[model samples]
Target: MATLQDYRNERLRKLAALRELGVDPYPAHAERTHTCAEVVEKFDELIGQTVSVAGRIVSIRSFGKLAFIKLRDASGDVQLYLQKDDVAGLDASRGVLGMKQLKLLDTGDFVQATGEMVVTKTGEKSVGVHELRLLTKSLRPMPEKLDNKEERFRRRYVDMNVNPEVRQRFIRRSKFWQATRDYLNQHGFTEVNVPVLEHTTGGADANPFVTHMDALDDQQFYLRISHELPLKRLIGAGFEKVYDLGPRFRNENYSDEHLPEHIAMEWYAAYWDWRQGMRFMENMYKDVLQKTFGTLHFRLGEFEVDMSGKWDVWDYAEVIAQHYGIDVYHTTIDEVAAKLKEHSLEVEKTDSIPRGIDKLWKNIRKSVAGPVWLVNTPKFISPLSKANPDNPQSVERFQPIIAGSELGNGFSELNDPIDQLNRFVEQQRMRDAGDDEAMMLDIDYVEMLEYGMPPACGWGWSERVFWIFEGVTAREGVPFPQLRHEIDEVTKAIYSEAELQ
Candidate 1:
C-alpha cells in the first residue's frame, strides 16, 4: 500500500514529467466558458456545441483508449468523456499528450476541458473532450473519506471537497446572514460596524478574553462579549434604528452549543416596545427561515417546530412553577442552590441569586419543545431591561424558545440613567463576590444613557440559530472551530525519552 509520502513522491515525478513535456503543472491562467452545473443545466441548448469547463477531477476511469472523468466545481459536478482519437486531433505536435496527461492527473488535480455535449449509450449527459489542459496539479492524495469529527473539522477544506453537503451548509450560512441584513434594511434599520476592543465589556453575562494593546500605552482591553452596549451608544447618538452583525468572544467552557468566538447580531429600534418588538421579530424569524432554509417546519432533535404557526406564550415564573415547584419571584438564593444540588445538577460556585435561578429555569426550559415566547422575566435576572409598568418586580423581556432552546432574546430598553447605574452597581457587587461572568460596570455607557435615548426595544441572537436548524453541533457549523494544538511525532518522542530519563 502506498503511504501519503509515496503518493506525494509519485505526483512530484509526474510534475517533473509535465514540465519536460512543456505543460505547466500549475498554470497561471485558463479559460472556462461554463461551469459543470451550467453545462448540465443547459445541456439541450449546448448539445453539439463545444464549450470550455473547468473543475477538479473527483473521479476517473480509463478503458485503454477511452476515459471517463467526474469533474466538480463549486456550482456542481458533471461527467467528461476523453477519447484518444479526439485528443490526437486537438494536439498536432504531441499525438498522445492527452493520454499521457490523463495518466498523470490525480483525483484532486483541477483541469479545463473544451468539449461538445453528448449522450452516452446509457443516456448519461456528458462532455466529450476534444481539448484538455491541467490547471492545478495536486501533489498529495486527498483522503477517500474523512469520518472522524475532529479530523473533519481540523481539515475542513478537505471535508468540503469530499462532502458536497458540508459545502452546502456553509453556503446556507451565508444566505442566513444575508437574509437577516436584507430584512432589517427593508424595515429601515441601518447596519453599522462596532469596535471589538473595549475598556470594559458589558451587555451579556459572559467572561471576556482580555488582551493588552501596545499602541495604547500597553493598556489592557477586553474583547467585546456582545454588540449591545456600543450599538446602544449609537441610539443615544440619535440613530433611530441601528444594528450590528459581527464577531464576539466569550471566555467560557466549550460545549456542543457554545463556542469561544462566534458571529452575533444585535438590533435596536427606537420607539418600539417589547410587544411591538415581539411581533416584528416573529415576522423577521419567518422571513429569515423561509429565505435561508426554504421551509418553516424543521425537526429539531425530538421536537418539531413550525415558524409559520402562531407562537405560544409562557411566563418565566409559571414555567418554573410548573416544572420545579418553585416561584422564581419568591425563591431565595440558598433555596435555589439547595434544590439544584438536590437534583444533582451542576452549579457554578460564583453564581449569584439571579444566576442560580436561571440555572433552575434552564433545567425546565430543556423540556419545553416550544415555538413559544417566554416573557415577563424577574428583574434580578434582567438587569439591563426596563421594568414592567404593571409589575416592577419583573422586566418586560421576551425570549423566543424553540425546540427546547432559547433562540433569541429581546427586551424593552432601560433608558433611565439612574436605574441603569443602580443595576450596574448590583452587577459590580456580584463581580466583586467572585462571579467572573457578571457584567462590567461600564460607566461611559451610563453617561451616554444620561444624554437621553429614545424608548426602544433591542434583540440579539447568534449563529447558534444555524446550528439548531442544520442539526449539527456548534463546532460542525463553524468552518474552523478552535482546537488544541497536536504535538508532532518528533516532539512526542522527545517527551517520552525525557519521561524515561
Candidate 2:
C-alpha cells in the first residue's frame, strides 16, 4: 500500500522526467477555443472542425496504440481521443505534448487539447487530438472521492473536483446574492457600500469582534455586527431608499443556522413602515427565489414552505401568550425563567425579561412552518423599532418565520432621538449586567437621530436564508467556514524542515 508521500514521490519522478524531456510541466499559458460543454453541446455544428479545449484531466486510458483522456472544465466534461500515428510531437516552447509523453500526465494535471470534434467507434462524442499542451502538472493527485467532513472543508478545492455538486451549490449561492441585488435595484434601491469597522458598533444584540487600528493611534475598533447603523445614517443623510450587502462579523459560536462571520443585507425605505416593508419583502422573496431556485415552494428540513401566496401575520405577544401562557408585556423575569427551564431552554442568571421571553418565542418559532409575518414585538426587545401607535408596549417590528427559523427581520425604524437614547441606555445597562450580547450605546447614531432621520422601515437577513432553502448546515453552506486552528501531524511532519510553528 502506498502512502500519500509515496504517491507524491512517484509524481515528482514523472515531473523530473518531463523536465528532462525539455517539456515545461507547468506552462504559463495555454490557448483554448471552446469549453468542454460547448464542444459536446455544439457537436453537430462543430463536427470535423478543429477546436481547442482546456481542462483538468479527469481520467486517462490507453489501449496499446490508442489513448483517450477525459477532460473537465467549469462548464462540463468531454473526452479527448488520441492516435499514436497522428498526434503531434513534443514542443517545449509551445508546451505541446506528443502521444508518447501522455504517460507523464496524471488525472489532476491540467492540459489544453486542440482537436477535431468526432464520434468514437462506440458513438461517444469526443475531440480527436491533433495537439495536447500541458497547462499545469499536479504533484498530488486529487482524491477520486471526498467523503470525510473535516477533510472536505480543509481541502475544498479537492472536494469541489471530486464532488462537482458542491461546486454547483456555490454557483447557486452566487445566483442567490445576484438575484437579491437585482430585485433591490429593480425596485429603486441604490446600493451604497458601508464601512465594516465601527468605533461604536450597535446594530443588533450580538457581541462584536474587536481589533486595533495602528493608524488611529492603535485605538480599538469593532467589526460591524450589522449594516444597520451606517445604512440608516445614509437615510438620515437624505437618501430616500438605500441598501447594502456585505459581510458582517460577530463574536459568537457557530450553529446550524448561524456563523460568526456571514454575508447579510439590509435595506431602508424612508417613508415606509413595517407593513410596507413586509409586503415589499414578500414580493422580493418571490422574485429572488424564482430566479435562484426556479420555484417558490421549498421542503426545508421538516417544513413545507411556499413563498407564492399571501403570508399570514401573527402578533408576537399573542403567539407567546398562547404557547407559554405568559403575557410578554406583563411577564416577570422569574416567570420567564420558570418557563425557560420548563421548556429546557437556557436560563442564565443575567437573563433579562426580554431575553427570556425571546427564548420562549424561539421555542414556538421552531414549530412554525411558515412564510408567516410575526409582528408587534415588545418594545424592550426591539430597541430600534418604532413603538406601535395602537400598542405602546409593542414596537412595529416584523420577522418572517420559515422552516423553523426566523429568516428575516424588519422594523418601523425609531427616529425619535430621545427615545433612541433611552433604549440605547437600557441596552447599555444590559451589557453592564454581563449580558455581552446586548447592544452597545452608539452615541454617534443617537446624534444622527437627533439630526432628524425620517420615519423609515428597515430590514436585514443573512445567508442563513440560502442555507435553509438549500437544505445545508451553516458550515456546509459556506464556501469556507472557520474551524479551530490545528496543524495535522502529517502536515507538520511534511513541513518540519520549514520550522513551522
Candidate 3:
C-alpha cells in the first residue's frame, strides 16, 4: 500500500537516471511528421518509410529484448515497437545507449518516435522505432480509471485523458456551435458581441449574479442573464439581422438541465414574425443537428426524438388544459398554486402569478415527448413578445419542446415603445413584489425602442441542446462545471483546535 508520494519519488529517481545517461527527460522541441491517426490511415503507402510521431505513452509491455508501447495523440492511438538493436544506430552523439533508456520511459510521459511502419505477425499495424525522445516527463501518474462524477469534473484534463468518448463529446460540442454560426452567417446574420456587464439585466426571468465595478465609481453591475436586451438594441440601431453567442450567468438553482454559467445564443431579424422565425428555426435545428451528430434521430433520456420529419405544433392554453386540467388564461394564481400543492409539486411563495402558472406548465411539460412547437403563449408569461392581434390576451410566442423540456424560445418582437414600457413597468412591479426572478425594468431598452425598431422576430437557445442530444447532464456536457470547494483530510489535519481559537 504505497502512497502517491512513493510512486512520485520512484519516477523522480528515473528522471535523475535519465539525466545521468545524457537523455533529456523534458525537451523543448521534438519532430512530428504524422499523427497517430494519419499513420494508421496511410499505413499501406507509408510502410517501410521512416516517419516521426509523438504522443503520450498510454501503455507498455516488455519481453526481454523488445517492448511494445501504445502511444496516444489527439487524433488517435498507434503502437510503437522498440528493440535493443534499433536504438544503437539512432544518434551518433549518444552512441549505442541501448535498453537502459527505454526502461526509464513510463506511461503518461509524452515521447516522440522516428520509425518505419510495419505489420506484426499478429496483424497489428505498428511503427518500428529507430529513435525515441522524451518530450515531457509526467510527474504524477494518471488514475487507473475515473469513475466518480465529482472527481471527473474537478480534474477534467485527467478525465479526458482516460476517457476517449468524453473527448469525442467535447469535439462534437465544438462542431455544434460552429454549425450554428455557419447557418446564421449563411442567412446574412451579423455576429455582434454584446457587453457582459449590465446596469439593468432583463430579457429573461432569472436571478442575476451581481458585482461592483471599482473603475466605474463603485457602481454595481450584473452579469448579463440573457442576450435579449442588447441584441435588440442593435436592431433599434438599424441592424436588420444580428446575433450573439457567448457566456451568460444566472444566480439560480442547479439541476440536471441548469447551470449557473452557460453559453447562450440569441438572434434577431427585422421584418419577420414568429411564424417565419419558427420556419427558420426548424431548418436551423435540422442543419446543425445533421452537421454535428450526422443524424436527425437522438436518444435523449428515455425518449427517442427524430428531427428529420415535420414537428407538431400545440397551443399553450390547450396543452395546459389537457395536461393539468387548468386553463392558463382562466385560472387564478392562488388556484394554480393550490393545484400544484395537490400534486405535491413545489412552489416558491415569492413567485408571481405568471411564474406560478409557468411552474405548472413545466410539470405538465415533463410528459410531453416531442419535437413539438408550443405556441400562443399567454401575454402575462411572455412580456417581451408582441400580443396576438386576433387574441390580445395571448402573445405570438413559440417554444421548441423536446424530450420533456423547452429546447428553445422564439417570439414576434414587441417594438411598440408604449406597450414595451408598460410591460417593463408591470415586470418591475412583480420584482418589487418579491419575485427575484422577474425581469428588471430596463429604461435604456425602452428608450431605444422609442427610436423606432422595425417589427422583428427573435429566438434563443443554450448549450443545453448539446446536453440533451448527448444524453448527459449539463455538468457532463461542459468541460468544467462549478463545484463547491472540498476540504481535504490533509487540510483538516493541518488546522488544529488552537489555531481555530
Candidate 4:
C-alpha cells in the first residue's frame, strides 16, 4: 500500500517530469476523439485520420531510435507505435518522458495518444502515433505481462489489458440484467424500489447489517435481508406482478459463494402455484441463458447442466430417506435421531427434531446429481407453505437444485388464514426455543392474508444463481466482497500502545 507521503512524493516527481516537457500533466481535455472500438470498426477507412484517445499505458516496446509504446483507451486497447520523428506535439524533448524513452517504464502510467489507425504486416491493428503524452505516471510497477495471473485480480486494470475473457464476462453480466429487465417487462412484471432500512427484518435467515437512525435518535435500523415483505405489499395494492433487482445485505460469513452484500433478482406472481412457479423459473432461466450465452447448456464445475431440458423432479423426503436408509415420513423421532447418530451425522435434534431433520436433509441434498426438484418437504420444516391436501404433514414446495446446490425455492403459499396462523405459532415456538433464524410474528402480513391474498405460489432465490451461472464463486460475482483488508502496521502499533495506556 502506498502511504500518503509516498503518493505526494510520486506526484512531485511526475510534476517535475511534466515540467521538463513544458506541458501540463493535467490538461483540461483531449480535443478530438475516437474510441478503440470505432478505430477497429472502421479500420481501413480511419487509416489517415488523426484521432485522440486516452487510457492506461499497459505495455511499451522500445526499439533503438523509435518507441512502440502501446496506448489503450476505453472500448478496448490498441497499440500506439510511436516513432522518434512524430513525438513533438504532446510532450517536450527532455526530462522523464525522454528518460522513459531511454530507460524502462512500469505499467500503471496513464497516457494519451493522437494517431492514425493502421495494421502492421503482422496483421495487428495499431495506432501510428503522430503525438503522444504521459497523462500520469506510475511509481509502482504493474503486471509484468497483461495476462500475468499473479496480478489478474489484485490489479484488475492490468488484467483488462490482457484478458479479453474478463471483458466478455462483464459484458455478458450487463446483457444478463438487460435480458432480465426485458423478460420481466414483457411478462407484466413491474420493476420497483423498496426501503432498505427496516424496523423489523424477516423473509430470510441471514443476519442484517445494523446502523443508527438519526431521526429516531437511539433507534437502530437494519439493512433489509430480503425484499419479500415490501414486494408483498404491492400485491396487496392490486399489482399482480412485481420485481426488485438490487443490493441486499446479509451480515454473515464470507466464502467463494457468499458475500455480505450481493445482487438479488426477486419477483412475485399473484395466483401462481408451486408448479407454475417451477415452470416460470425454468422458462425465464432458459430464456435468460439463451439470450446471454446463446445456449441453454452451462457447464458448472465438472458437470454440464442443460437448462432447457425438462428439469428432473424428486420428493424432498425421499431424497433424505434414500441417503439414510430410513423412511423419514413413517419413522419416529427417536428412530431418525438414532439413524443419524449411527451414520455419524452430527445433528442436534434434541434442540428441535425439525431442525435436526433440516440439518440431515441439507447433508443429503448435496449428493443430488444435476438439476432436480426436491419437492414435498415436511410441513413442520417450511412454516410459510401450504400443506398438501393428501399429506397434511408435508408442504407443497420444491427446491430447484442445480450443481448440487439449491438455486431456487418455491412453494404454494399458505393463503388459508387459519393455516398461516398455526404456522406462525409454530415459528414463534421455534424462536422461543432460541432459534433466532426462525420467523417472527408478522401480524400485519397475517392481516393481509386475512384480506384474501389469492392462493399464490411464491418463488425466492438468492444471488448464488448468478454466481453458479457465471461459473465463478458468489464472492467474485460481487464487486466489493466482505474479506478483510489488512490493518496497517503503523495503526496496529498505535493501537497496541493505546491499549497499554
Please report, in order, the local distance difference test score of every candidate based on alpha carbons.
0.88, 0.92, 0.89, 0.72
**Model 4: lDDT of residue 276:** 88
lDDT of 2 by residue, 1-501 (tens): 987888788999999988898888877777899999999999999999999999999999988679999999999999999998878998987888887788899999999999899999999999999999999899897888799999999888888989999999999999999999999998899999999989989889898999999999999999999999999999999998999999999898889999999999999999999889998999989988899899999888788988899999999888888888998888689999999999999988888898889889988989889989999999999998899999999999999999999999999999999999999998898899899999999899999988999989999989999999999999999988898887888777767898766
lDDT of 3 by residue, 285-371 (tens): 999999999999888778989899888999988877877788777878788888779888887778656877788888878977789
lDDT of 4 by residue, 1-501 (tens): 876456546656766756665755555555447776677778878887787777877676787666665655657777777667665533353212442443424456776677777777678787877666656656555534565444355556556556656767777777787888898899889998988888876677666788988889879888988887777777777878888888888887877677888777777788888888888888888887789889887778766788878888888777776777767667667877786687677756344667667767767666555678888899877887889987898998888878767887787877787877778778877787777667766778788877877666677776687778888976456544454455556446545756532
> Residue 198 of model 2: what lDDT?
91
- TM-score head-to-head 2 vs 4, winner: 2
Worst 10 residues of 3 by lDDT: 88-97
List of clashing residue pairs for candidate 4: 272-457
TM-score of each: 0.94, 0.99, 0.94, 0.85
Q: By summed lDDT, which 10 consecutive residues of candidate 2 come out lowest?
A: 492-501
* Model 2 ranges off by over 4 Å: none
Please provide, for model 1 over 202-226, each residue's C-alpha lDDT reduced to its tens digit, 9 standing for 90 to 100. 8999999999999999999999999
Candidate 4 segments whose C-alpha is farther than 4 A from its true place: 1-12, 19-22, 28-32, 63-65, 90-106, 119-124, 145-167, 325-333, 349-351, 488-501
Mark the regions of model 1 whose C-alpha exceeds 4 Å error after superposition: 88-97, 487-501
